[model samples]
Target: MPGIHPTTYLFAARALRDFGDGFVAILLPVYLLLLGFSPLQVGIIATASLFGSALLTIAVGFLGARRNLRWLLLASASLMTATGVAMSLADDYWLLLVIAFAGTINPSAGSVSVFVPLEHAALTREVSHAERTRMFARYSLVGALASAGGALSAALPDFTTGIGLERLTSIKLMFVIYALVGIAGGLLYARIPKRGASHETSRTPALGPSRAIVLRLAALFSLDAFAGGFVVQSLLALWLFERFDLSLAQAGVFFFWSGVLSAFSFPVAAWLSRHIGLINTMVFTHIPSSVALMLAAFAPTLPLALALLLVRAALSQMDVPTRSSYVMAVVTEAERAAAASFTSVPRSLAAAASPALAGALFAASYRSWPLVICSALKIVYDVLLLMQFRHLKPPEED
Candidate 1:
């Protein structure tokens, strides 16, 4: 850790956490099915995880301004470790539900963990306004690539079964690995400086002048998150399994390629933001991706659906880095942590509401409803975002 930059520690921690999330997202539904739970139960557990993350994130946002972010990050890492350990050992429905709510299992490609707002605030402090977007892009790229690797690793269970290992034992081993990754992430986070080189203690409220803008953005983000929850990776994997009878190995391969496409798009998004501005980059790229998702829901053949899904993956995530940069750019330094938490909390809650409904639809054999609803709502969010924010450029833009 001596020669490494502090930001590098953050990047490494992100990679470890994201790798765990990526595979968990793919494996959660399958694991639940193996345990004799219905799809609705799987969706409920996913909601519990997001909802708990939102509540914890709210606490972090409020406390982050006063506490050492390094300690807070370390604490989050500890919770992640505990979550994984509990998950590996528990099979009871109620106990698993409790762990899902209290632990760090993510059912989506994007994280809603307590780590997100903390890391966003930390990353913003490490770079100047001019460099913020690209820094976030690199941060996101690291996560995406690591997630791709994790997605590929989901096939380990399939391979292990071939070697005469019990399928259930192999799946449980993945959770144990998840716990180990949390410990590894904790070690890297410990290397981060206790405070930024330019850090200063401030007693001002976490949100002041930026309160109105932050609230509005949070509302809009909530809409998008709600739409996204319907197609959270767990549910999407369920769709593939039910719709096409995809094997776990096949789903793993598809998601790995999808994650890779998303990872590479981060830099392209940074470049696109420079040319078209963050809001434009977010809106324009998003519309087409939503359209692709909608079409994929109706595609008749497996190949056609997979091809459309890959197209959606490539364009859908271009907004991620840009969105993080935009939020950080608009808020004051003191408000950065609060701003991140505030924006993310609503998004998490909104996202938490839908998975159950999507699962119910799937349970009823209306397999396409979730995807269609998700795409339509996402398109609406994109249009609304452009209308409200297109002219409200960030400080760097000015």
Candidate 2:
């Protein structure tokens, strides 16, 4: 413990955050469906939540620049935990929409999804430059495993007895549990900054550092995320239901494996990056992965289809860490947080469009179309990844 850095609290918070958010991601679609919501409506709710979370990242980045991260983190945790509690108690659709959009808490899924970069920037400020990529790789590893565990926990309902309780009730419980886990993570977060509250904090300058390139990446990220929106949970659940008659629990299992395969794939990808470069690692892995996703749409059996999904999961996320690392690597060290937000904001907004689109398609019995669109959009991103950044490399370790 003597040599260990003080900021490890972020990792613990990230792991717990992933566990809670993973559960919410699996169940929220089913929750909306039980309320008699259409696919489009379900998609809207999902998109709203996404935008809500995305908007907060800006606040976090801004606030984190001048404020103590511990205080900012604590506040984000409180807001998110409170929102999850609100989600569990709310019954009306409009109010749920309000909560979804207005919520500010940085639950694990949302936090690590966004905050890890903040963590990276923070740690980069605290540690030597030589270790940044290594730190990020470790951070991503923690999140992947935690989320995979949460995804697997989706099977819990399979063991619950009886079906008379409104499905809404069970879904609310999932939200409650997710919130509690987040609260627990927040509590644990108190321990993450091991150096204690006495540690001095400095403010970050808000001025833009590499304006043009960051915005370009953000634009491309938006395209990929917008396409991703179609396959949001309601649509994915609806996809399985219409196509394979899969129950929520069953689809949860599929998502569980999806996370599992994703969790396992990153390490291999890190290895592959050594040979092909991070940018190449992003495209080659993704092209085949996108094709597999398209094929899953036509799968004849649940097992075979699940196999395709698992394969897609394995290859698709290989780009995640590399993509993240590439963005950080490309910009000047001072601009890291802005670079993360520039790309991440558009990514969030683009994905925000999907749920509503998927829902509309479902109402028209054209839910399957979104998958095709999603695939095409993703293929474009993969191509862009290859052509745009293939020659880029990280600053070599000292």
Candidate 3:
């Protein structure tokens, strides 16, 4: 860690935020159930969070190039703080819905927030082009590990209830802790140099030369994200609960291991990208994982489904760090922030549209149709991505 760039601090803050999201992601659906909300309502709230993030991130993508990244990050963290506080204190359905829309309450295991592109830009600035992939791998590794810890933290209520605290009280306290983490994250972002905003200026084009490539990537990424939305970790946990009768603690354990499995793949992806190239690594690793997901849907027993899920975990996330690195490598420096935002915003929108559908699908059937649907769509995305981008290598690859 000694030679690590200052941008690693952003990764540290990301880990903190993700940890809070980890437990809360799983806890959300369960908490809603305890509050007498139907599955469809839970899906609506999740959709609201994604849709809100998409709009906010679109603004950041456009305006961020002309503004202080440090200030924007601080503001985003402040919103996280507000979100956590409001959700913990409010019980009215409409009020909770408003909070979900306005705040950064991720229902998924992944980190999708306005903070993402800003941090990507900052982290890219800190590293040489040669170091970008490795650095992103480490960034993803830290996030996955922290998220794993957070997943395990879903058991906090079990411990709290054992000590005589009310179940709802214990769950609410997790949100309070989320607020505290946001305060810490804001402080961390504050320490970032004022020069983080130095890239923003009057002369910068919003997207510069990479506009076309960014648009294409955004469209493709949206497809992948849309498939992802159908089986986001929150809804997946709910499925396991209803479909297999998994307890909260058991689901926590499952996700904790899944996160670890995914974490282990990041470095492997970085190494693999060095050999097979980013596009190849992305296309090849992704297909098998999607296949695993498809097979999981057909699994007749819980143990078989869990095994397939673990396999999918090991292969699924190899593309994440690689995809981020590839995008940064292809885009011009001036367009980095815009590219990150534009690409991610579509993903958010696509992902946002599906949870309600997934909820309805889950509500209407005992079959794991959502998983099947997720796999088929993801496979289609993989094939299309390979066909479209096979020749588009990053500069380092050339």
Who wins the TM-score comparison? 1
Candidate number that wins on lDDT, 2 or 3: 3
- Model 1's C-alpha root-mean-square deviation from the true structure amounts to 1.3
What RMSD does each model have against the real structure?
Answer: 1.3, 3.3, 1.6
TM-score of 1: 0.98
Model 2 Cα lDDT, one tens digit per residue, 201-250 = 23335435567777777887788778777775446756787778887667
lDDT of 3 by residue, 2-84 (tens): 56456767988989988988998999998888888988888888899899999999999987787878899999999999989
Better candidate by TM-score, 2 or 3? 3
**Candidate 1 structure quality by residue, lDDT tens digits, 40-142:** 8999998998998899999999888878899999999999999899998999999999998888899996767799999999889889999999999999999
> Cα deviation in Å at residue 147, candidate 2?
1.7
TM-score (all chains, Cα) for each model: 0.98, 0.89, 0.97
Candidate 2: 10-residue stretch with minimal lDDT: 194-203
Question: Against the unseen true structure, what C-alpha lDDT does each candidate score?
Answer: 0.92, 0.69, 0.90
- Sorting all predicted structures by TM-score, with the top scorer first, yields 1, 3, 2
Query: What lDDT, from 0 to 1, does candidate 2 have?
Result: 0.69
